[model samples]
Target: MTTSRSFVLICTVGIFCFISYNMVRMPALSLFAESLGAGPERIGLIVSVSTLTGVLLKLPSGALSDIYGRRFLLRIGVVAFGLPPFLYPFITSLDALTALRFLHGLATAIFAPSALATVAELYRERRGAALGTYTACTQSGSLLGPFLGGYLIHAAGFSTAFVTAGVFGCVAMVLFYSLHLDVSVPQRKEQGTAAVLSEMWKGFSVVAKNTKVLITSVTDAAKMIANGALMAFLPLYGVSAGLNPGEVGLLFTVQACTSFFSKPIMGRVSDRMGRQPLILLGLSICAGTFVCIPHVSMFPVLLLLSAGFGFGEAVVSSSSSALVADSSEFKTLGAGMGMQGTIMDIGHASGPLLAGLLIASLSYPMAFGVIAGVQLLAAGVFWVTMKRM
Candidate 1:
C-alpha cells in the first residue's frame, strides 16, 4: 500500500479501537461495577485492573514485536479490543467484570507500542507530527466515548452499551485487517526460544539504558497520575459541586476536544522547535490547572481548567512519544515504546488508588494539591536530567 493509504488505515484503526475501549471505560464501567454491588474500593480496583494488564504485558509484547513483527502483535491486539465487550453482558459479578477488564487490557498492552513503532518507522523525518496525529485520532475516540456511553447507558441499558461498543470494535478490526504495509522492520531470525529471549533481553537493555527515554517516560507518568485521578473522581466532584450528570460529562468532552485539536499542532511545533521546551511548559500547565481544579465550582471556570489540562496533556504527549523514538536505537523502537507504556500504566494505576486514599483521608483540595506537587517535582527532575542531554 502507498504510505498515505497505510497511514490513513492505521489512524482509522486507532480511532475505532479507542472508541470501543473507552466506551466501556469511563462512566459505564464504574456504573456497571456499582450495579454489581461494588464499593468505592472495589470499583477503583476494577477500573485500574485494565492498566495492570498493560503494565505486565507492554514491555514483552513490544520486545517481541521488535524481534518478530509489528503486524502479528497488532492483529492480536486488535482481536483483544474487538472481542472482549461481547462478554461483558455475561458478567454476573464484580469479579467477573474485573477479570474481563484485565483481559481487555491486553489489547492496549500489545497494540500501543506496536502501533507507535510503526508510525515512527513510517515517518522518521516527520515523526512528531505523525505520532501526534495518530494519538489525536485516538483522542477523538476519547472525546466521544464517555458522552456516547453515558447517553446509551441512560437511554437503553448496560447490555446495549456493551453491544454497541462491540460493534465499533469489530469495525476497527476489519479496518486493521485491510491494511497492507511494507513499512515493518525486518525481523530477527532467532533459531530457538533461548535465542528469542536473548534478543528480547537485548532490546530491553537498550531501552533501559537510555537516559532520555527513561526521564521523559517518568515525567509522562507524573502527568498521567493527575489524569487518572481526574478520570476517577471528577464526575463525583462535579456532581457534589451541583453539576448534573450531563455537565459532568461535558467536562470530559471539553478536555478531550482540546486535546484532539491541540496534539497535532503541538506535535508539529515539537518537530520544529524541539521537544524539551514543550514538555516543560506542558507539565507546568498541567500542574497549575490540576491544582486549580478543586478551587473552582463554577462550570465555566472548571471547563477552562479542564481545557487547560487537556492542552497541556496534548503538548506533553505529542512530544514524549517522539522523544522516546528519538532516544531509542532504530531496531528497539518497539521495546522503548513498550517501556514507556509500562511505566505510564504504573502511574495511571497508581493515580486512582492514591487519590482514593487521599480523598478518603483528607479533602479534595488537599488531594489535588499533593498530586499537582508531584507533577511539579517531575518537571524539575525532567528539566535537570534533560539539561545534560
Candidate 2:
C-alpha cells in the first residue's frame, strides 16, 4: 500500500493491459481488415475508429476521475481491455471490426489519465523519471505484443492470437482487482449528480485555459501523428517490401525496444536539463527519420529508421507528460492529463486518414514526407510559442 508499491502494481497492470490491447492492434488488425476486403481508406477507418473514441471520451473521463476516483475508473478500464479481445475472433465484417475497435478504445480513454495523474501525484519531485519509467513499462507491452501477435498469426492464425490476447487481459484484470491501491481520492461533500457534473466542468475549464499544458500537449500530438501513421501502414509496407508478418512485427518490436530503453534515461535528463530543448530535438529527429522510411526497401535499413524514430519518440514523450504535470494544478491533474490525451488522440486519428488519402493518390514516399513536414512545422511553432511564454 506504500507509494512505491502502488506504482509498481500500476506499472505491472499497465504492461499486461497494453500487451493485450496491442496484440490485436498491430499487423493483426490491418491484415484482418484486408482479409475482410478493405481498401486503404477503409483500413484507415477501421484503425482510426479506436482513436476517435479517445478523442470524444478521454477528457470527460479524466474530469470524471477528479470528481469520482482513479480506482473506480481504472476498474472499468481494465474490464474494457479484458473483455473486448474475446469478441475479435467473432468479427466477420469490416463494420463489426470497426465497431469493436471503438468499444475497445474505452480502455485507454478511461485508464490512461487517471494512471498518469496517480504517478504524477506519487512522485511530485521527480515526475519526469517516474512517468518515464511507468510509460516504459507500458512500452514493454508494445515491444512484446506485436512479436507475439505476429508469431501467432503466422503460425496458428488470427483466432489463436485473439484468444491469447484475451487471456493476458484477463490476467491484468485479476491482478488489478486483487491488489489494494493506496492512492487517496479527493473528498467531496456534495454527492448529488448536478454537483458532480459542475465539478467535472470546472476541471475541464481550468485545463482548457492553461496555455502551457495546451502547447505541450499539441507538441506531443505532432509526434503521435507519425506514430499513428506507422501503426496503420508499416505492416503492409513491410510485407510489400518482402518481409513476412513476423518480420513486420519485429520492426515494431525494435522500434518499441528502442523507446523502452531510452525513455527513462531521457526522462532523467529532462528532469535536470528542462523539457523544451528535448522536445524540439526529439521532433527534429522524428522528422528526419520518418521522411526516410519510404525511400528504403532493405530490412536492416528499415529497422534502423524504426529505431531512430523510436528514440525520438522516447525523447519527446519523457519530457512532454512531465511538462504537462508541472504546468497543471494538483486538484485538476487528471483533467490536465486527459486534455493531453484528447489532443493527442485527435492527431492520432487524423494520421491514418490523412496518410491513407495521400498514399492512395500520391505514393508512400510523398505521404510520409508530408507527415514528417507536419512534425517539423509543429516544432517551429512550439519553439516560438514557448519562447514567448
Candidate 3:
C-alpha cells in the first residue's frame, strides 16, 4: 500500500483500538465497582462523570486539532487513551476508578474528532463513503470489545482483562505514530493563540446559527442518547430477562456486526436517497425496536429486537456524520467535527445516567421505553426541519 493509504488504515485501526479500550472494560467496571461496594447510582455516577469530561473536552480538542494539526493532536490523544487502561487494573476505590475514567475520557475527546477530521479530509467529496469505512472500524471494535471481555472475564479475571486492554491500547498507540498520518501537525506557521481561538469560536458560532446544523446535530444527539442507553443498560436488561452472559454476548455481537456491515451501504443509500427519509426511517425503526425489547423474553426474539437498534443506528450514525461534514465549510472542518462531537456528547453524556436513574426509580422497561419516545421525538424534529431544508 501507498504511505497515504497505510496512514489512513493504521490511524483508522488505532481509532478502533481506542474505542475498544474504552468500551471493553465497561462490563468489567460494573462488576468491579459492585464488588467494591458501589451501588447502581454510584456506578451511573462513575460512567456519567467520564462522559461529562468528554462532553467538556471535545470542543477544545477539536479546536486544538484545528490549530495544532490533526496528526500531532491525535498523537496526544492516543497516549492519553492508552495510559488510563494501564491504570485500570491497579485501581482499588470507586473514586479512584472515577478519576481514572475521567482521564480516560480525555483520550476519547482527543482521538475521535481529530481522527474524524482526518477521515473527512481524506475523501472530501465522498463524505458518506469515507466516513462509513472509517467509522465502521469503530463499530467493529465495539463488537470485539464486549465479546473479548466476556470470555476474558469468565476465563481469567477482570484484572487480566484490564491489563489486556492496556496492552492493546499501547500497541495501537505505537502503530498510530508509526503510520505517520498526513493530518496536519499542530503548530503555527503564522498564527497566535488568540487568532486560533477566534477561528475555533467562529466555527462553533457558524454551526450554531445554521438551521441545517442545528437540526442535524439534534438528530445525532438523540441517536447518541439511545446509544448510551444501549451500552449502559442492554446487558442489565438482558440479564434481567434471564439471558446468560453467552446469550447477552451473542446479542451484542449480532447488533454490532449488523451495524458494522451495514454502514457503507447506508452511507451510499443516504447519498442517493437524501438524508431526511433515511433519518426518519432509521429513527422509527429504533423506536419500534425499543418497544419490542420490553416484550421479548426468548433469546431469539430478543436478538431480533437488538438488531432493530443496531440497524437503525447504523443508518443514523453513518448519515449524520456525513451530513455534519456536508453542511460545514472546508476551512472550519476541525471545528465542525468538534461541534458534532459536542452536540452528540450531550445525549451520550445523559443516556447512561438517565437510564440508570430511571431503572433505579422505575424499571428497565420504563427507562428504555422513554428512550424509544425520545427517538420518535428526534425523528419528528428531523422531519419538520428536514422538510424546510
Q: Quick one: best lDDT, which candidate?
A: 2
| Cα RMSD, model 1 | 1.5
Query: Total backbone clashes of model 2?
Result: 0
Candidate 3 displacement at residue 152 in angstroms: 0.9
Top candidate on TM-score is 2
Q: What do the candidate models score in CA lDDT, each in turn?
A: 0.88, 0.93, 0.75
| TM values, all candidates | 0.96, 0.99, 0.93
Order candidates by lDDT, high to low: 2, 1, 3
- Tens digit of per-residue lDDT, candidate 3, span 81-119: 666776777788888988887777777788788888888
lDDT of 1 by residue, 223-247 (tens): 9999888877886788789875557
The list of candidate 1 runs beyond 4 A from truth reads: none
lDDT of 3 at 209: 74
Model 2 Cα lDDT, one tens digit per residue, 1-389? 99999999999999999999999998899889988999888888888899999999999999988888899999999999999999999999888899899999999999999999889989999999999999999998899999999999999999999999999999999999999987888789998989999999999999999999999999999999999899999988998999998999988899999999999999999999999999999999999999999999999999999999999999999999999999999989999999999999999998888888888999999999999999999999999999999
